[model samples]
Target: MAILITAKNLKKSYGKGKNTVHALGPIDFTVVEGSFTIILGKSGSGKSTLLNLLSGLDSPTDGTLVVAGESLNKLKSGKLAKYRAKIGLIFQFYNLLPNLSTLENVMISSWLKGISVSKQDATSLLKQFGLEHRINSNIKTLSGGEKQRVAICRSLINKPAILFCDEPTGALDTANGQIVKDILVKLNKEGMTIVMVTHNEEFIPMADKIITMKDGIIESMNTQISK
Candidate 1:
């Protein structure tokens, strides 16, 4: 498989001098196209920071980062926003607009791309995720698991080549979390590259590769047969 993301001597930090905090690399890494990879790390282990850097949401203080063939280090703010749309991001919080219905929330993401996503498609995706009845419901009225499902629908609105998820299953119960995991794995099988950050060990069984990070660097990486 071809490499979809590559980092060389990548470095990021917070504060300065005595208060400095190293959040990532001076390390090299590559993610193969269409692979489902899990990044495991505890709090303060730089998992979130690394995701931001990889997605071009933040600039690195030093070194080089390239994702999906774009040099993130070279993008200006406007360019970065466009770059981000190509790689969908799902967060622990659904981040839906409270006033918008579930279907509307999903459509809004595609609207940002200036494309009018069909209601039929949005409804189909949500229905497949077991949220057909919630299509016209207000986001604030939904349960935690339902909200997360809406977030997943929004993330896929653009049909991105890659998905970056930060604790996507964090707020859900075990059954719902597993449901989300299965959906992600199905998407990966259909050729969507997924890079997810999670502390949940249950996700390990679904991962094509497991990458563990400690402090500001990768501690270990293990690949397994895609089941």
Candidate 2:
């Protein structure tokens, strides 16, 4: 498989001089195309920081990060924005617009990208996620699981090559979390590259590669036989 992401000697630090805090890296890894990769660590383990760098949401303090053929560390602001548009991000909280209906929430991505919003496509995607009946309902009225599903639809509407999820099921109940996990696994089977950061051990078995982090560095990386 092709390598979809590469990080070489990546590092992230906050503050300067005496009070400086090293948040991540001085680490390296590659994400295989169409593979499900999970970054597991306790809170403050720098997993989220690593995700931010990989997704082009933030730049590394030092070293190179290449994603989908673009060097994130070298891209200018405009170019970086363009690159980010091709990547999807799913947050822990259902970051939907409370006032917007499910369909509208999904349409927001197109609107932000200066592209035409396709209700048909949005509806189709939502329906695929079992949210067909909730399309017209306000986001505030939906359950946590439904809201997260809507967030997934929003993330996918632009057809991103890779999806970056940060604690995707953190706020859901056990059953709902399992539903979200199943959805992710199904997407991976259908060839979507997924890089998820979670503290949940249950998801480790589902990933093609499991990366464990401690303090601010990778402790171990385990590759499982893909199903």
Best prediction by TM-score: 2
TM-score of 2: 0.96
Q: Which clashing pairs does model 1 show?
A: none
- Deviation in Å, model 1, residue 131 alpha carbon: 1.4
lDDT of 1 by residue, 1-227 (tens): 99998889889988999999888987678899999889998898887888899877898888888898899977899999888878788898878889999999999998886778899999999998899999999889999889988999999988998999999999889988888888888899899999999988887987888889889788888887854
Off by over 4 Å in 1: none
On residues 47-132, what C-alpha lDDT tens digit does candidate 2 reach at each position?
99999988888888899899999999877778878888889999999789988999999999878877786799999999999999
Q: List the residue pairs that clash in candidate 2.
A: none
Tell me the lDDT of candidate 1. Answer: 0.88
Scored by CA lDDT, what does every candidate get?
0.88, 0.92
- The alpha-carbon deviation from the true structure for residue 95 of candidate 2, after best TM-score superposition, in angstroms, is 1.0
